[model samples]
Target: MAEEIKVIVFGLAHEEYGIEVDKVRTIERMMPITRVPKTLAFIKGVINLRGVVLPVIDLRGRFGLPESDATDSSRIIIVAVNDLEVGFIVDSANDVIDINTDSIELPPEVVGGIKAKYLRGVAKIGGSRLLIMLNLSEVLNKNEIIQLEEQEV
Candidate 1:
């Protein structure tokens, strides 16, 4: 009733982003991925996590940002999408915060050149910090999700 919800904060391309915490499964350090041929450019490969094989996408690549070599802070954020779980690589994830829902504003046509469909909203935090909220479903759009499922078949 505080008009607030918790989010898992992460970074991609030096910009901040957030996702509803409930959708996140886990966060892991960068790991080895097996290349899957003929897939989308953003789909780096697949990672065998524990006993589950999950597709991993580089958020930067998906967002059409310049690729950078992985650093110590690189991370994989596993998130549940529809009936499958996928992993997304980010620069890092270090914060869990409660952001007031009322503070969120409709996303502009573009943010740093990222497509508007990929965004859920934009929120101002701490009077100066801006956080980009992502619509996971849109980020992994229906077409992409379908392709991923087909690859599994």
Candidate 2:
């Protein structure tokens, strides 16, 4: 049998979610951000990391959840989308977990307020634990990001 795909899971507003580890580059603590006016509410702002300006988005806010102040557990999970680097802020990062394809199921008609179209699948962990696997490309599409950038300009 083929090896199960592993993903790095995290929490945002009490919900567990994950993205393929291969898609994730690194995870860092919350850094200073320069807020840009007239952008999407989910976009907290941009951060300069090692000379690279990365746009940071609050996953909770993106999912239409109440915004909260960054805490010690807050982290920015850097991911590569279409060769572009973007940072996503989460409440806390859990750990890397391997899940078999058979263990993954299609997301229900809806997830919280997010449409299932944005999800890749739902991974079942322990008995009652479920992790929503995200479709990185759909979640961070360049066109949408560019649109937000244009709004800032």
Candidate 3:
């Protein structure tokens, strides 16, 4: 039997992306975010969730995708990486599936306009569907992490 990993799949710009279930904390519906000054463009500021303030990142902006207004289907995915817990605003998060690790392949230079440096790998699911796995560490790189820390409120 092949090693299977559970993935929390979400939509971004009409494409599918997954994050290992272990890295995800929770997924919530779109909520109000208070903007902070001088932070990164993609950093959509912070959100107050159940008494805890979490910095939020707009994944579309983070991936350099076209900006679009949030809709009813928008969601906020909270993930913890490198001792930092942050929220990522995604188009929608509606699937959780188990995938065979063997099905994953090295990422090409670019996938869906996102650079390969921010990806872990690309997985082929059901032989036709592709899932882009994000390297959270690289997505929340050390330098950016420092900046986020400084903006803590």
Candidate 4:
């Protein structure tokens, strides 16, 4: 796939990451998320988005990173994976970038301090711009999603 692919870029900590743009449904600013008890720490909670409840996962917590205070730039990236829509809390939801497949290289066990297993690849753009491509399947495949789907709240 040497053709250009669109990706939605976001920030977490001091690094940048990207997800397939087609998978993204929308981006919303920080919003109230009702916490769910007895759930994983990464599963922050769920939010009622336009009459539809979406499970929200804290990306930092999911990646085992230290939590940073949520800022105004913080956003919830709504994406559809496995026919289920969920929200991923990120430091910020930036722009949509076009990356040529040739610029992407296999993740080297670790990228931007996050495990490679959670990444699909790394894109080197413009010589110094590194965009870590996230593996949505791996990031959202935890059994918690199943639990969240069963939950009404």
For model 1, name the residue pairs that clash. Answer: none
Give lDDT tens digits, candidate 4, residues 1-153: 489999999999889999999999999998999998977777899999999999999999889899987899999999998887999999998899899999999999976568888999999989998999998988887674567556734
Instruction: Encode model 1's per-residue lDDT on 1-153: one tens digit a residue.
Output: 448989999999989999999999999999999999877777899999999999999999889898888889999999996876989999999799999998899999999889888999998898999999999988878686577658756
- Over 1-153, each residue of candidate 3 has an lDDT whose tens digit, in order, gives 679999999999999999999999999999889999977778899999999999999999888899889999999999999998999999999799999999999999999899999999999999899999999999989786577657764
Q: Alpha carbon lDDT of residue 36, candidate 4?
A: 87
Off by over 4 Å in 2: 144-153
Q: Which portions of model 4 miss their true places by more than 4 Å? A: 143-153
What's the distance in Å from true for residue 99, model 2?
1.0
Clashes of each: 0, 0, 0, 0
Report residue 121 deviation for candidate 1 (angstroms): 0.3
Residue pairs clashing, model 4: none
Alpha carbon deviation, residue 98, candidate 3 (Å): 0.2
Best by TM-score: 3
Off by over 4 Å in 1: 144-153
Per-candidate alpha-carbon RMSD to the true structure: 3.1, 2.2, 3.1, 3.6
lDDT of 2: 0.88
Residue-level lDDT for 105 in candidate 2: 91
Clashes of 1: 0
